[model samples]
Target: MAISLSAARLAVKSPLIAQPDPSHTVWSRLEPLATSDDVSDSLQARIADPLWMLARQWQFNELQGEDAGSPISAALAVVGLPVSTLLHQQNAVDAVTLPAGAAAIEALVEHEQVLSVHPKLNAQAGQQLMRRLRAAGLPDAGQVLRAQFPAALPAPDDAVADNAGFVWHMLLDQRAIDAQALASTLKALPDRAALEAFTSGLGVAAAQVGSAADLLSHWLGWLDELALDGSAPGASPYWQPQRLEYSFALGAQGDGPPVRLQADEYADGRLDWHSFTLGAAANLPGGPSEAFDVPPKDAPPPRPPLPTTARYPGMPADRYWEFEDGRVNFGMLGAAKSDLTRLAVLEYALVFSNDWFTLPLTLPTNALYRVSQFDVRDNFGITLTIPPAGWNMFEMSLQPGAPVARLDNALYLCPALNTLEGPPLEHVLLVRDEMANLVWGIEKRVQGASGEAIDRKFESTRLSTNQTLRPSADAPANGALLQYTLQTPVAANWVPFLPVRKEGATPANWAIQLQRGVVTHYYQVTASRLADPVNLRYSAFIERLRSNRFVETTGVQGAVDNQLQGFMFHPRGSLLRLDPNAPVASDFLRVEEEEVPRDGIELKRRFNYARDAQGRALLWIGRSKTTGRGEGASGLKFDVVTRGKV
Candidate 1:
């Protein structure tokens, strides 16, 4: 216990030595030199020392890069030519100067009334005309007109006769009314001078108004002269019921030769540059009209290039701390092996998002352009000339076995059309019938005379009632008796297409064409002879033939005649002509056998309208094709008998 009393001091020392924190030294404050005198600039998080930044870049392996210099300035010399002429039906004989807008072409091809006048609008126009006549000092003008020319006024409830043409027909037709009686009844007109003034205002010859027909004609003409929202029917000369295809030529102002382009399938209201193909090109003095010259008067003066930045949806942010849009979450995408599209999208978003650069160039619409010279100056003061080559994006590809070569280095800015579409007015199902050894064009829906969509099935059902004969009373009393049918009748909407040998093909060739076929209906006749009391003979049924006998069986005709006589598809040309003729004399429609697959296809036509950049509204009818519900059974059979519960 006394060991604690010894005061023995012992110090334990090791080789390790401790030193003060170097950051606490006053000299350390001056270690990081501020190159900028401004306090805000010095406070920035960015490293001021270039060497340190370069070292960090090297650590990130950014130094081992494409070695290409960043572009500082670029000069692109382009030339554009406006479309000057249009050719219809692919015929040079039908060529004419191009219209001011593509809507005219659409309206003409689709048979859409460019100046569509509704019944209400027609009535409004008539009321406005009457109001103007009254304002011009005609006392009780509306009442007097109604009383004197009762036939000219359409009944308020007569929707069918509410059109402008109907009013003209009733008023201006000599057969519709007695000219002398109408003239005598029109004595309510104050004097001949007043009548002449009215005729002059209507842009009609005053001397032609001697008869009632002429006066009514003048009145109808005056009604049309009023300001209306739409153009008159047949106003566009480009419209042709038989010809839907159109082509055009783009040319500079007396510079280079014109380039001809064509659109064979403009049935779809959407008119874009992709709709056309290079039809022809003329050779220039140098070599060919490879590029056109922009009209000097129309071209803008040379100016500095406006800088453009590239961006895309669902792109990752450049900085780690930056916020990103949550609407499109690439991480949430669950891609499977079969989801190649998703994989490609992910690759584009994550890997190649920043690989694109944008070059801004303003070009006129409805024109063809070509880059004559494109030179880019990089940060290293190196100028690189990029010549027109085959590596063009969104370039029109040469159609398979096309007669014309690809038009290289061409850019077409077709008339910009952004359309809004209504529900399909017509729907046709093109299906293959393996059992019948034929393909069918089923008219699911067809446009009626009043422009309403009618269900073809319902119409066929309604018309086909009591068409087929019932079993005769002469049938045998045996319960097991059989009844024979020459051929089962198919629905009128199911058109038949027979496969025929392709034209000009060798015997070894496997090509065939699907030609329109006819379906004939035959009636059965039973005959009984006294020689055989228990047995009876039935005559072979004869086909009831109509006058001219050769009918084009496009099933839709049975529901509504001449409904399908318009734009259809063919192999040689994208569009086929369906001629309107009598059922007995109609021409057969032929299509390539390969166009119809085993699964089938669907075609639809819908009403569409669009507003152009200049705020002009264009209306048209467009067509679309989609995958159909597989093979269909038409229930057609030959020489079949049923022994059922009857």
Candidate 2:
């Protein structure tokens, strides 16, 4: 969007000026028009030169809208006509200056030759006459403009002559021309050719501009600058080449490795090659040992009509499962499992794979309490590796699941059971924010063996629970093993907005989001329920607080620099300090409480306070406080928390 200077100035109460947009292509297109010498004298002479009579006739005929198939059009249509060549090759004649006084104007007015063709000058004609007179050294005109006009015109140097064709095209293509301004500027020059050239060049520049009014304004201002001894008009510095750099990886679906590529575009139009590597370089497993053929693309079959009744009696219509072709479809119904658990599993499968029934098919028994002759099999070790090449860079992103979003190879591991003796095999899927920082994760723990005591040796480093693993149809023949997946219960939807520059970072922290219109920011407060893994399982909590201690406390921390900032979109259309009209806070504390269990009995409260550092009014909450029943603080209680950045 174009920034409105008037609006901003009024809002900020400052004399704001509009800055030129660097993204425009005008400067690049006009670069070839630059010249080193003043060719106004030659151009002026060519306008009245006898040698150019034929060319002028041709141009005049074309402008008069003569017959399309006229002989003149045919003759002038040749690509390399001598008249056209000569027109470009013509050398500028000596310069001529306007005589000081009204004598020149009077002579033009009284000239019988001029009057025979035209009775009286119109407003535009009169204006042109005045400009010509002034340029030719009118006594009342300022010498400053006269001196500057010549310098601004294209010079008589080789550069100008060689690109004469381009100059001609520019002039002829101009839809509008400020005749008076051009005449005034050219008349100041001594050489008639240079004068004409200057006028034509102005026409070209004006045509390059968006509107005639703008062209006129810039032209007059340029002449004024020359009068003050300023340099000639040229492209602004904003048009200069800008260097840019980018890096990303093309990732594949279903446990596939990624291919990374990085490149830098220099200001000089040169590309600097950077690093490239395959995801397997990080020691990831390669494709499966068995040969495989990719399935040909096929249009999905039409959906079957819904059944009038549930597949089983007492079943809700929406909750019924139907098998068509090879796919089984089912919807959420409280009769089978909680809506939350069912939706979570279904959604997860939808994101990672097309088959949502894979896990549920392994359930111990169907809700119908009928045994079906179906066997559940695992896709473990079924190398679904993606090729490392043939992908576009644009497909890469800075979000978890994207190739460029993470460096952790663990995220690609498929669900599997290693040894029956060891604890249940667990796999985690994590998601990172735009900054490539891990924000959420989910843990799927596959049951190992029934009555098997989990190795508690690593209890401190893992989440533990007392709940027995639920058995599934795919459970090992030795015993009934349950497989379950859990993720954090936090409902975080934080988004980054503004970028924060950091030294030596591949991708600097960008996007400081405006969480609430009130500028309330949050960080590490609660893990996202959607993507984050269940880090502190309730079982883990029980194990840690098994001691007799009546109160227990736990806190999680990560990179201290990760933070959130709040801001208010001010009336001026810019970010303003939150509560700008309020008095400065000497010590202001803000508190927030969230109901997690959907029951008022369990709660999580967050407290944020003013942070003063390096003379900046920063807001920070390094630590968190949690108060709950028994194993922790009894009932509800306020906790003063102060710690490091999370």
Candidate 3:
């Protein structure tokens, strides 16, 4: 059994080592090496470490007074450990190496023995020790109390006779206070004067002059304002603007009692109102009524003289007039000479820049489309034609289903009307010409309260999204617009290119067709991975191998034993095939081999294929390397052969 086992072990040769591929190198299993060390020593010595107790007693005695016993004597009474144990374990506290060791030292100092053995030590001494421990990066016990109070409050242990000061600090900083202490403090203040004197005596700001009730009310009002303006503790700064939103039930309030209009005195006097329903229409009659006499076209009315009649003091009667030349005449008793004054006409031109300093009006085209109830009948035609000298890249105009009207040079209006009359109709204007690319921001140029022609200028060069544009006066051009920007729609997320009528549950599959410089591009992409199967294969063949054999039966220590005389064993041809069920559409191209470093050869092949019947082309890569390994046998008895494994 022993000889057979030996022969079997000898026959089990190590697998032949193949030359590695130069095109790729194996990577380390760990991206970064980790470090580890045992912390047993510090943890084991924690119970007997007397340095912590000694330090605690030393600090306690210092706070107590001079002439206190030595630190060792206090430590002996506190820890009661033997001198050898103390000396041996002192290093654990003196040189803390682990977080657990620090924790153990803290436990030793804060142990219950301190109060029993040295009951006279004030908490202040222990607090100072705690501060020292905190500085040393050790766990502390005062964190909970400190966190509850304002960070600006001096630690109570450090300050002398600061109870009242700490109380005031807590109240001012919105920190919690003991209810009993607070009540007593308030009760002691008989009046605001006394309270103020007490506060001043404590070096704190004076309380307002009033009774407790009045003082409380003032403080509460101030707190409320502070909260509203976001100035309270930990609140966002007051400079950040707060958004106020108001929603009214239009149908419910339309016919209700009229609301009184109140305006702030400091307001800019500019107000905007929007309505969701269609606006009121003029009640013009289609045909003439017979309530009055009608005159022939181009004919003068008959002239009638005024009738002089004497009427009773308390009664009045209606009388018909007799027409002679078909004219009625009336005269006033007094007439003054009227003079006509000739005024100079101020000729001012409004110029919008196409390239020069232009207005920041990027038409609020987005808002126009967002209107839920725009009267389609109110749609008007707007044409923006650059003068012959300007470049007309393209034209942008409102389309059907989106009502837009051009009022003047700077205002294009899209009114979202609410027939029931809740808010004023929202007017979304495309304030600039798209072809000109001149952005114009809304500016209100008002001259007091008089109704006058508005002269607005572009305030900015770029349009900000969701910005409210308020024009001072009516626009004067045929193409006035509020600037807007269009964002790229994410594929499979939004179908912005398609005409949206009703919002759907999920985004519809849509394509965008864009005409660019020479080619028109069509794009449609979905966020899904291809699920087609693919095939891969790798093959190599051993060309030759050499073998050696020895006849010695006695095994030599640390020496290789050979058998079957001298022989060359080589296996040829090997293949690894993977048929991944993927759609193959094209033949492989650019198949070639390159000589790599260390006499290595790499084969690379690329092919175009389709994953499905959609005919979309995809590229695949095939790469492999071939090389020789191991040294040839040196003895002549060793022979070389091929095509078999030994």
Candidate 4:
């Protein structure tokens, strides 16, 4: 059922103050409009200049949005948009003076514009802003923001205007950019190979960023430094010979690998040969590996409908199972699709393989079970990868003048496309959070079939014996449901909230948790009675104990150099004090004694063992105190006690 979680909703507290968010895109989207034309024409008129107008318009139309005039109005509206406020914040400077501190605020405002050009300025200005902010008594605001993010940027000094647009458009960051100018610089270079060669050996250097926002921010700063404005944009400003070129590749193990690149001799803003990697180098012989086809995509006969009694579930609740109660309806996707103005790429991920246990397919606590995504063309891409038995799917529409949230986020959008009249083309799209618009989409030969991609399910984890759960055939429509009950017996090893600790080599003389009740909880679904297997978990916590905080805090003898100062200690190699909070073995002890305990007790002949007046045991017993349910569980006496006098 659709329950509105009160915790997720945002309540507007102020217009000027920033709101907390999981996604920081709203801030960057609204920034241009925040102090520009539509919302604050006064501010726009105040900073009005040919260069500013040209740059802003180019950015609006090319880099990110269709901001009828400005993105402000939409960014501040609270109704449908995620924004919590609309009114602007008070100006920083309020008044201006000659000192660098006085101009710092204004400088920040201008820096915001050209920040994409010079990233180093951001840190510099940040320092200046910190000083001025302290002077202004706004240290609280000076603290790093939780929702702060990168901005967009145009390409660096390159000479291919169209390519510049492509570069900025496909950015993974959101910062200011002047791609037209950078692209122009690259275009002026002789050819592509030369262009690639010039950038081959190059890597992001000091004061520069690789993300879109950093790129653009630094670009703007460079403009200020060079006394150039991109209102007059260009393509191919740099040119070079073909010998120097480069490409990017994932390393040998398919993880992050160093890039292979080169650069040309030609150097100048006009044109330079810079060889560079453009996109993922498909290790496949000719191109990217073609995605394997499945049978469900074609018009295959549908399987018998699952019984109406079947329940659909998510983590703890069965969403579809409560359909009669109007909790969740699969119809929401189609309804949402009808309402959306434009459609961005939708993604689906079905975890086919996972690492959970020595045994396979029982379900793993460490693995994720849900796979889904949705984008408002610009907002977020909609995708879903639920259990293999998912009940519904969401579709999207592409349109003209779509009122989509100008989502061109930190994506690498390339050769933007529009909806077509026929069946969608066969393509495999690879998108990453880092590269939005520039997805590695492989236009493929449409395979006429599709199939269930999810092979494994997330298994239930029993943290406590008091909790019980079960799996249902008719539950959790989209995801799986895990239901729990109270009073479930827990595993001896299970304990909630505490990090598991293992015993160290020199065992601390401690008591043993020999037994409990007859029944116990399991590491995996003790709640699900079926298919229980042998060795579902390790034997009853028969493990040596690690040093616990209690011992660390209370141990008084283990101290050395101020460590373990607060507690008592049982030293092995030396007389050491124990500090509970410090990670053990990470640092040395605060203080230590020259002589250490050299011998330990042999419990076999001892019942109440200890050193006597002469430091020797006078009497001893073999049996330990055992009573009640634990006694029966361990096959020992229950209720009664055994005593003997010497």
Best by lDDT: 1
- Candidate 2, 484-517: lDDT as tens digits: 3232112111111222232343545432321111
**Residue-wise C-alpha lDDT for candidate 4, range 620-644, written one tens digit per residue:** 1111111111100112122433343
TM values, all candidates: 0.57, 0.13, 0.14, 0.13
Model 3 C-alpha lDDT per residue in residues 1-646, reported as the tens digit of each score = 3356365565434444233445755322213121322222321224335677555445434224433221110000000000011100112223212221111111111112111111112122234433543453432222432233222322221112224334434432323222222333545677766655543432222332223334433433432222111112111111100110111111001122211111111011111222122111122111111111121111111321122223322221121122223231111111122211211110000011111221111211101111111111111322222222222222122222222231011111221211121111111111221332221111222111111111211111111111222222443533423423232211110001111222232457342221100101111111111111110100000001011010011212321321111111110000000111111111111110111122322211111122212222222111122332322221221133324322
lDDT of 3: 0.20
User: Where in model 4 is the C-alpha error above 4 Å?
Assistant: 1-114, 117-249, 254-327, 330-646
Greater lDDT among 1 and 4 belongs to: 1
Model 2, stretches more than 4 Å misplaced?
1-424, 427-646
> Where does candidate 2 have its weakest 10-residue lDDT segment?
80-89
Candidate 3 to truth, TM: 0.14
How many steric overlaps are in each model, in order?
A: 0, 42, 50, 161
Candidate that scores best on TM-score: 1
Superposed model 3: Cα runs more than 4 Å off:
1-210, 226-271, 274-646
Candidate 1 vs candidate 3, lDDT winner = 1
User: What TM-score, to 2 decimals, does candidate 4 have?
Assistant: 0.13
Indicate the residue-level lDDT of 460 in model 1. 44
> Cα deviation in Å at residue 553, candidate 1?
13
Compare candidates 2 and 4 on lDDT and give the better one. Answer: 2
